[model samples]
Target: MSNPASATGTAAKAGLTMGALGVVFGDIGTSPLYALRECLQALPADERSASILGALSLVFWALLFEVTFKYLGFVMRADNRGEGGIFALLALSHGEHQRPRKGGSWLIILILFGAALLYGDGVITPAISVLGAAEGLESFNPNLAQYVPLIACVILGGLFLVQYKGTKAIGRIFGPAMVVWFLVLGSLGLWHIVETPAVLAAVNPVHGFRLLAEHPTNAAAILGAVVLVITGAEALYADMGHFGRKYIARAWYFGAFPGLVLNYFGQGAWALSHPGDPTSPFFALVPEGPARLVLTGLSIVAAIIASQAMISGTFSLTRQAIQLGYFPRLQVNYTNPDQSGQIYLPLVNGALALGSIWTVITFKSSNNLAAAYGIAVTGTMVVTTIAFYSVMRRRWRWPLLGAAALAAVFLLFDGALFYSNLHKLVHGGWFPVLVALGMLAIMHTWKKGKEEIFRRIYANEITEDELCNVAASDRIVRVRGTAVFMAGLARGTPLVLLHHVKANKVLHETVVLLSVVTEEVPAVPDAERVEVREIGQGLGVWRVVARYGYMESPDVTALMERVRDTGVPVKLTETTYYFNREMIITGGDTRLWHWQKRLYSLLSRNARPVRDYYRLPPMQIIEVGLPIQL
Candidate 1:
């Protein structure tokens, strides 16, 4: 018999795989509701059967190559400490090319844009998914079509409202619900497949190629619509941390992929039998009565689940961005204290809520929103493929030919999707592009402004020897207890510390100059997390450099413990934290333009206090205001 402990471990892994199914697969799983119908809309009425088969073939191969082979086979292996996404990929790629190189700026730009593009995705996915599902109500009664947008808006609002609770409470049922959703998707498709077994022939690659060759003009349009099937492709890699690579891969291969394939082929079979029917082929698979109603309800639930995943993903992305210093510090709440990833950002949530609600109200229908959708997803996919290529070459030490070959195949498909989606720009596709551009501006400004501010702040930084000399001199009096001075640079004394010593004319008996550095990876190993150095010849003046990965939230109390573990014992109760609060006056900036300075100043002024973000006790923390023009 198997060991009881081993059995429990196996069972737990299986459970995580199930949970991965619910959150990760919801977006792609629900694509069957509209992806096929939208693709068929691009086909000529005269050759409906051939077009349906070809489109189905393309969808099949796209999933096979993009999701199955490209992601699971290759890109998943480039994960950064269990976390995967554009940012994680950037960190992985940067591991080898640590120094700035010729193409480094372009690579960084692409990665930042790829991340910014997700906001566009966050807006479109919910509007389209929920709208697509609610549109199913139209199948039962055509008069219900007018209510679809309103219903979708209500659902979207409700989904955003609950994000504050995090996914902990409702996440339990996500796996089961999505499992049933996929089963129904497959069963409905299978039910139709039995009636029309010829749909299976679409699995062959020839039909897709034939469509591309025969109707090159219309193929672009069809491909644009077909790309919808893989819209949620990034979530597989994005949520790799929440569920391990193995579990996500298993969930996709065993649960999501098969179900999606069956459903798409099943829709194609149904469309072949009933050509020129304007009704949605997905709901049409179920008989027009109560069964369609049930499927519609399931579709709505699945869509909401998809929206939830995207919303939660935005929260995670915002936290990572802030931790990586690409964005200003925002208010982050951890709903589940035990789970670090289960965070909620109110600013991100409000922005997404407004954007999504505006999308629903503006588009007013899934079909309209569909026009705006694919660009961000396709752009992100292209960036991901490129980032993966960089990793294959630099980190994995793959031969140039091998890396180029891998990149060429993936980019060919990704480029085609992105090129085709460009047709949407005039017809509402501008929304995501605009959102991405706006986000890029904000991120670029914040990063540039922060760099300039740091440059100015560190220009007068005193070295360890200088600080040691001052500490040993009789010019300064030593007080009781430790004063933990937070600094931007690890070695130099913080400006705030200088200000404190100059004004108060006294220093703490035990001075801990704490510097927290965010490294490029997801999580730093505990052994490398803290580095303590004696600066004043055992005068109790020590420099502590605490390194954190981008995925981590720094807890000063914990950092103190680590410092204490290194023989520098300190009590948090007695120690006071010092921070420099920069009063940014934007008129006299060194590099930034007037508008950029104003924007950066607005962001700086509104950013959460350094003490609060670091989780220091409000009472014990003292902020020294230093006015600076930038």
Candidate 2:
């Protein structure tokens, strides 16, 4: 007889593994629709069979080395409190510093750029995946080719529209659908592979080397297409926090990897048999019949799932950025009450929808969209490799030589893929780059402007003794009820609290100065979340520091409840929340350029208000305006 707890654990792991298949593997699993076809299309027609085998060989090893070894084996281990992503890696690399360490600005810039590139990936992934699947109609019927873009746009619109419902609801349907999808992928490929058993020889790495050696000039272009095989690899790490490393790895090895391998080789076998047939090997694998239509429909569904994964990842990344102070605050909605990770951002969704739909309408074909795809993926991959090195050296405290040797190996592959995609810059690759640059600018400005504001506000800070003296002063009127002043700085009096006392000449009978700090981790345990300090001998002036992980949003009401548990006389109903609303003036003296200052001001103006972001009650909230010039 087995233990009941063991059985329950096993069942839960299996459920998570299934969910991982739907969310984590969707992008890479759908690559069979276009990855092999793109590789073959990039090669010479005269040497069709050899090129097919070589491309297959390259794709095979790329997945084995890049995804299986580098990411899942190494980078996932660098997770920050069980959360993984570029930002998580950034936090780990910086050690325990809430702020960047000395000379860490460069690393922050690099990581921010990596994050910006992901937004680029988010835009292109949806457009290309849906378009690639929709293009299957061309093989189904030549006349239907013209309707592909329209169909893709409609699918994309619906996908974004349903985001408000969140991923937890959609993942339920997506999980089983993907299981069937992968089964079909493997079975179809296996059928073709048996017909041409020789295709299995491509498993040898020599075939991959030979392809590149023979066509040295075309090697870059060939690798550029091959990079598509592992484009979704980063999602594995980015979404690791949602699904554990064990479940994601289990899903990859058992489900995604085998299906993808068999399909690519099957496509290779099909390409070899039908030499000079200019049809897409993916769609051509099925004969012209109702079966082809069924496969096409499955392809579209799979494509939508792929797009959904990217969009969801973008939402998670944006939340992390905003909480970490790299980006301005945006309205974040928790889509699932049970899951904090499942969130939706309206502005982010709207922007992605417009960008994705515009991409579909403009490119009109997956082939054109593919030109814009690899650059962003490879660029982010390279950044991840570099950032991983920092984690190994600093966080893991690995030996210098050991870290260098391992990072160099990964960087070699990353550099080759990134350099190969450079030729695509003029051929629609500029789309992602343009998007990344815009995002980089906004992030840099927000970070810089925030720092300047913090410095200016705390320039002439008051000590606890000074605040306590003010509390004891006879000139000050003690009003009834409690007042909660939100402090930006964890130490000393907040400028807003000081200003309120000076301007209003009145203090609450019980004053609570609350400071919320975002730590360099994913989630803080509730026990370690709040710290309280009492000021003066008997005065009711208190300082509370509430610590939250970058993954969480602060709730003043909940925090106060926690404070009340600590024997403080704080009541949520009787408490009035006070916030500092900064009015950004761009023309003041600062290191920022005229353009950046203006941009920073614009972002600040549009940022979500502190009251809404912190979930403070509207009736008891008071906003104190403070003018800050940049």
Candidate 3:
């Protein structure tokens, strides 16, 4: 079942689709600014005709095979708590409890790796989107080259600047802007197609196939060409929970799909008509003078919207990643309760802003920055293919061979795109690979460290029965209210409890051992997740967990009310919450590369204040600092 708490029935169904349109479609929507033009930039005259057709064919096939078959058909079903993202889907497909019990499994390892790659994605999205949009400045005046970086910086800064205000304020503008983007793409491209009817040949698969066969080198470039069109493909599936699977499906079929096809074909027609020109056909599509200026203004707005979609996607993805334990927890704020779509993440916003500005300055033009654009998009797509197969076999219970067949078609296309982007690696693509690698390192290291800490502190050897004996014998007076103890593991004694008993030697009469478990699915039902039981005596263990949709948060107060009927009696005067505070040490027996442990420790201390995030009362909370040797 989808996440039970947030979007439900009609709201989820409609929200999912619209959310996808605003977020998922951003990368692909803005591709018209350069996808066709870039393909032509790399193709020679004899192969140009065939290249155009072949590129279009590859783009079409990539969308249908990789996007439609792999994601739309399969991975969307692998939602975690009703939320969809690479990490969330990975957590869903990977068995959390079972793997932890098994200890050191590849399933767990790869899941962490996939999550790290998303950070890579977070950095790359803004870089390319803003860079691509800023490159349009060349259309007005090639001399604008020196100023492109400045313009890109300004636009990116503005994007990050408005994050605190939340998307609802700006989101209204996104839909309308994208609508304008589509109209501009369609009308402008149609004008060129009207002039050169022969351009229609590119729509045929044979032309695309022939072009690739004729010039293997040029065909290799089609991988990058397809990259342009499918750049935003991940957003489609990542945002599945936001819009629901159906809404994204419709927006693609209706709004985004038609506009992209018409415009790309239109670019082909223009190229065919003006074979001698080296400048981009997209600029040529606009009527010169004030009209061109107006179109440019509109394109700029569309670019911002595209960036916004990706930016919001980053925040949403980070939330899922944090909730799923791929990254250290950061502060997550909800701007709109009714529209679960509105969220603000301060760290993520700041990071994206800095990265985007650095990219714009370093490349100085979209053409140069465009060189680095495709790898992460296509890499994530390839990773999704593998994850998609897992979903098919494990989640969907699809037969192995059928899943393989479908995945093969999709991965081959995705592989082509990835290989295609390799050509740009030196040009600018190295940046994303660097970003992805750095992110992967940080994620793996932190997970390794945390897990090591979990292993060390949790001597599962000490049974709860033993703790119960110790707790009962201790001469601690019974408090009228319940004191909640949040534990990392269910049955194993929490280090906090042991440490508290050792240091304080007192137990609350109503000692509730609470643990919050986030399942793989996007949403968990209250009946299934929230449980309160009597573990006996003044020491009753309350296993309380609040499930977050890909959109919701892990708020403690909200959950307390949800599970009130559970055996743990609640009284504000009697209730006191406890969370463990970790103190880091440099030297320890850890599998982590030393640097990662250091980074993880630094990150943990600074993450969002847990008490405030959960909306727990200040006086009613206790944090115990448990020191660990890394």
Candidate 4:
């Protein structure tokens, strides 16, 4: 008889594996729409057959080494309490309690740059995926060629438009649809492979080596295009937390890997047979009939699904960044209550929509967009490799020799791909670099600006003892009801609290100094969520620190209830919240450039109010304006 607990766990793992196929593999699964075509286009006209085989061999080996071996084998193990991504990796490597040792700051910059590249990936993935899929219309009816961009733009717009509604309803279908998608991919490739059995010879590494040895100049360009095959590899690592490492690995081994290899080989086989027609080898595999139309429809569906995955990923990444203090707080709306991971960020969604549409218009076709794709993906791959090596040494405590040996192998592949993609810098590759640089600047400025502001504010901060002395003396009067002062510093009395007593001439009989800290992990246990203590000076003063994980929404009202439940009985209606409203006066002594000062001021003014984010009652909230120059 099957044990009930074991059966339940088995069912849960199976479900997660299926879900992973839909979200994690979407980008790579849809790559066949253009990756093979782009690779073949970069090759010389003379050695068509050998080139196709060589490219196929490269694609196979890339997946084997990069995605299968490096990410699935090594990177996934460095999870931060079941969460994975570059930021999670950064947090793990730095150690939650310890200050980063020696050159850790530089490591952080590398991780930030890597994360910035994903935004480029986010913008370009939809444009290229949808356009590549839409371009297949030409195979069915040549008249549809002119409408590809328009069709792709509309599909992309629709994809972004529906993001707010959340994917929960249709998310169930995504797993099954992707399952069917992979099966069809495998079946199509198997059919073609049976017909052209000779194409199997491409599996040999010698073919790939020979092509490079024969044409070193063209090889780099071909390598640039070949990187497309591994474009979505990072997503595999990024999305691991949504599905556990075991489940994602199960999905990759059982589903995505087989489908991708078979389909790629089948496309290569078809390319070899029809060397004259350099049109999309993916679509050409199907006869120009209803079957072709069906394939095109499937490709578009797969592309839209892939686009949705990236858009959702951007939302998650932005939320993490905001929690980590790298970005300004934007409105993060959770769409599904049952699933904590399901979130919608309006500003991120809007920006991504505009960027994707602009890309579709600027490139005009997937073929043109292909040049812009690999740079961001390869750059991110290199950064991921470096960060992973750091994690292996610092977090995992692997020996120096072992870590260095592994790093050498991973960097060898990552470095080659990165250099190959660099040739594209002049040809549309600058788009991602520009995007990454701009993002990096904003992130660094925001972080530095916040730090400088904090430094300035805390320079003359009053101590808890000083506040108690004031409370004890006749200098300040003690009023009736409870007052909560929101504080940034963990130890010092908040400026707003001190100013309130000075200006208002009185303070509530009960004063609570509340501070919420965002931790490095995804979720903090409720047992460790709130820490309360009495800072006694006979003023009924309490120092409260509420800790939240990066993934949590801080609910101060709920925290108040918890405080009340723990013997500090207080009525909600009697409590008043005090907050500091900072007005930045720039152009003083600042490390930031003049324009950055202006930008930081702009961001600070427009940031969401602390009271609102903490969900405090608006009517009961009092704001104290504090002017500071930086």
Candidate 5:
């Protein structure tokens, strides 16, 4: 929503297929080779026959219901300024009913927490998806187990190896390779399906329902199996900006959806006919010897494509989070603007690479790793459901009955995955839960910190006219250069100014009280953009409100350049920027949890390097330390 020149300039109305393929399909595309396999691996010893069929059935329906209806059909339509993601949805639903339904004002806190957990999931998905695929090397050669760690290390290193150069170089390989990956998956699954025609019986939703009812004791885990199919479906909705809604829909419906369904059912068919085979269901589907060699080779390529997609998606999500203020500002390198297929985030890339390599070594194989994967991924899906319900009621204006019906259906599916993964709580599931908890702490801490600053700064009301009168007074001393005052309130007093006149006896003309206000709208139109008010005299108050799309960075200097033409007779030379340097005052009256107070202190200090992050001139920056405790 910022200018195209901001980062990889895909127009607001640019074509979306290529972008969607590189971004949206990354998580889902890799499912073809693993979703069914993981579900079957988790099945109980005695229930192989029924559980395998059930897992396949669940994967099929999960993809259809989660990706097709819940997200693509309805959620994508709710994009804010053609941008999609949890934050965008929150922006769309903001102020629709003053505060949200449950305890009202607390809803923002809930949405922020959900998004925080999503960030944790983003970190894990790439690690697990790639690690699971690289495990394929062992199935080809049992002796390869000794070398699995080495092989995984190489893959992980190679993955991060290409990130700095940007996605554009490898993007050409993504779509075409994914295309072949899908075809290979579908054809292999189709061949197996033909061999054992009865596997198609799982298509009936009743079979899925029957599988659970028949095996009540194992139903939760069975449904948990299917949830893997739709694990990445959330990304499709989250990355609407990378690829348009329509293109993602087309890609899923035409390419990814069919390929996944075929591969899953085919795995089920292979398991049924060749019941004695002990290897993974995926390997059993392939004919022996040279054919297995070919399948293994293709599987590796498909896995790489899948890994690339997840890696790219992670970069994009981090970018979105940083722009929305939920994440610390990150360094972004843009590869292709004509296409939304290329981007690189150094911090995220490094974190994911380390995490993936560590996971591979820790779990050793996909079978062992399978237990931990479902929990983090499903937790994200459940949150997506919560966010989607909000979308239905507010954005779509769906009736109570309609929203209830869809939510009820999806919640049932979510419940199964949730309960099943509960069995995995100790076995790797805790990591994601732990990660989510950490995310909650960071997000809530930031929210409370932001509010504390806003409330303190906004309490005192000072208009441009008041500042102008004070500057024009006979007794006031004047300082040269542009006085860039940072404000917390858009319509009230700014702490920087309040501190300025109180502490220092000097006042300067052209006072700019810049309050970076994140709007409910993703991109505010230029006319409705920044609110600039000149209070006459030489003293001017520019309430330059910065509105950022979830995918934008709010650079104060860039906005300053735009404000110059709006009646303020100010030149940009020798400008000085002011910030409230807060010191942690522990022994004082407070209104926050003790732990939250401590966290706020730490975050305030660590928040993006103020000068460099904001692109301000380092030598021109000034800090006025003021201690306050909430």
Candidate 6:
């Protein structure tokens, strides 16, 4: 008899793989709508057959090597506690050191830029995917082409509007919807392939090589267009922490990969048979009837699903950035109580919606937006490879020669792809670059300002002995109940506590210095969450350090319960919480430029209040304003 446990395992894996299809593969899976069309459009029309076969061959190997071998076979192994992303890779490469090693600053800068580039990708993916799908209406009725952008914008708006409902509710239908979407993709492609078996020969690498060898001038352009096929590859790795490597790989191999391959080949075959046809190969694959309209509707739904994945990924990335101190703290809502990863950021959602809609209106068509898409994806890939190399050498302790050889091979592909897209800078590629640079400046400024504040706060240290003496002093009156002071540093007494005592000349009978620390990992176990220590004998003063993963949001109320469990008298409702409210003043001497100082100050002012962010009892909280110069 088969083991019941084994059957259960298979069932759970199957469920996760189905979920991965909806969320992880949506971006790449939807590429067949536009990738092949754009690739063929970029090549010389004189040699149509050679170009079609070459483009198909190139796309096949690109997905196999880059998405399959590079990400799944290798990069996924570098996950930090089962979390994978540029940030996770950065943490792994840095190892146990809290600070970057010598010459590691460049790696940090590179990774930050890559993370910022993802915001650009987040904006473009939705615009292009929705527009690509909406363009299908043109094949049904030529006059509908003029209204494509409007239809796309409406779909994007509706998608963003429903984001407040959270991913769990929205995700229920994603798996089933994408399953149907991929099935249609495979069916259409297979139908065409049966009619023209000759297109299967495009699977050979020789055709891809011959295209480049024969057409030297258009080589870079050809590669640039071809990069579209693998634009969603990074999403596979970035979303790995959500579903895991095994399930995501299962989704790709069994569901997404075969469908994508067959569909792409079918598009190529259809293109060969109908030369000089101006209609979209994707929409043209189906007969001109209600069946085509159904396909179009399905494409729009798939595009929405693709956009949802990117939006969700952006929320996760923002949370990670804030926890890691690279960005200002924003209000994050946990949509699902069971899943910490399901989050909604109102500000981030609004910004992305606006950016995506603007892109749709500006580009006007999927083909136009395609010009702006590849650079951000390729730039991020290069950064990931470089960061992965550092992880191999430093964290995994691989031999230098082995790591270098492997990274060089990956770089040869990534670097070529990035270089090929460089000329696109003039052709709307500047959009993502501009967006990335703006984000980089904001992130760099926030981080620098925080470091400056950290250094300034610790410059005049208050030791435990000093705090104890103040507590025991005859001039200071000891009041009833508990006082919890929020601390920026794990070891130092919060400046707010010192200010409160100095201003009022009184102390609470029970004092708790609570510092919430975000570790580089994804999630910390409850048992290892909090560390508590008594400050002095019989003084009723304690130091508590609560550890959390970058993927987690700290709940002060929940933390207090853990503190009470530690035998410290921490009442959830009765305790009064104190927080430092910094009044930032610009124009002081600092490493940051004049403009950055102003921007940092602005971001600081707009950041969610500490009590609000932590969801503390607002009525019992007190804010002590402390003015600081940048």
| TM-score of predicted structure 4 | 0.97
Output the better candidate (3/6) by TM-score.
6
Supply the global lDDT for candidate 1: 0.87
Runs of candidate 5 with Cα error greater than 4 angstroms are 1-15, 42-52, 95-106, 288-294, 315-325, 328-345, 461-465, 502-504, 537-541
> Which ten residues in a row are the worst by lDDT in model 4?
1-10
Candidate 1 TM-score versus the reference:
0.96
lDDT of 1 at 495: 90
The residue-by-residue lDDT of candidate 4 on 1-630, one tens digit each, is: 111123256678778889899989999999999998888988898877768888898889988998889999998888877778988887888754676443127888888899999999999999999999999899999999999999999998888888889988868888888999999888888889999988888889888888888999998888898899988999888887777777788899999999999999999888878888867889987888999999999999899889899999898888888877888878878899887779999889999999999999999999999987899999998998889888887778889999999999999998999999897889899998999998887777788888888888899888888888877878678888899999987888999998888888897888889998888887788899988888864568888899987767788998999987775645688999998998999869877789889988888888888887788898899999999887
The residue-level lDDT of candidate 3 at 363 comes to 77
Query: What lDDT tens digits, residue by residue, belong to model 6 across residues 500-605?
Result: 9989999988899999998888888888999999998998899999998998899989888988988997666679999999899987887778898899899999
lDDT of 3 by residue, 164-228 (tens): 88888787666656766787788777787788877776666776677677778676665676677
Model 2, residue pairs in steric clash: none
Ranking by TM-score: 6, 2, 4, 1, 3, 5
In terms of lDDT, the poorest run of 10 residues in model 5 is 1-10
Judged by lDDT, which candidate is best? 6
RMSD of 1: 2.7
| Residue 331 Cα positional deviation in candidate 5, in Å, after optimal superposition | 4.8
Q: Per-residue alpha-carbon lDDT of model 5 for 447-479, expressed as tens digits?
A: 666666666655566775676676677677776
Give the clash total for candidate 4. 0
After superposing candidate 2, which stretches have Cα over 4 Å from the reference?
Answer: 1-8, 96-99, 102-104
For each candidate, the alpha-carbon lDDT, in order, equals: 0.87, 0.89, 0.71, 0.86, 0.69, 0.90
Better of 3 and 4 by TM-score: 4
RMSD, every candidate, angstroms: 2.7, 2.5, 3.3, 2.6, 3.7, 2.5
The reply for model 4, stretches above 4 Å from the true place, is: 1-9, 100-104
Best-first order by lDDT: 6, 2, 1, 4, 3, 5
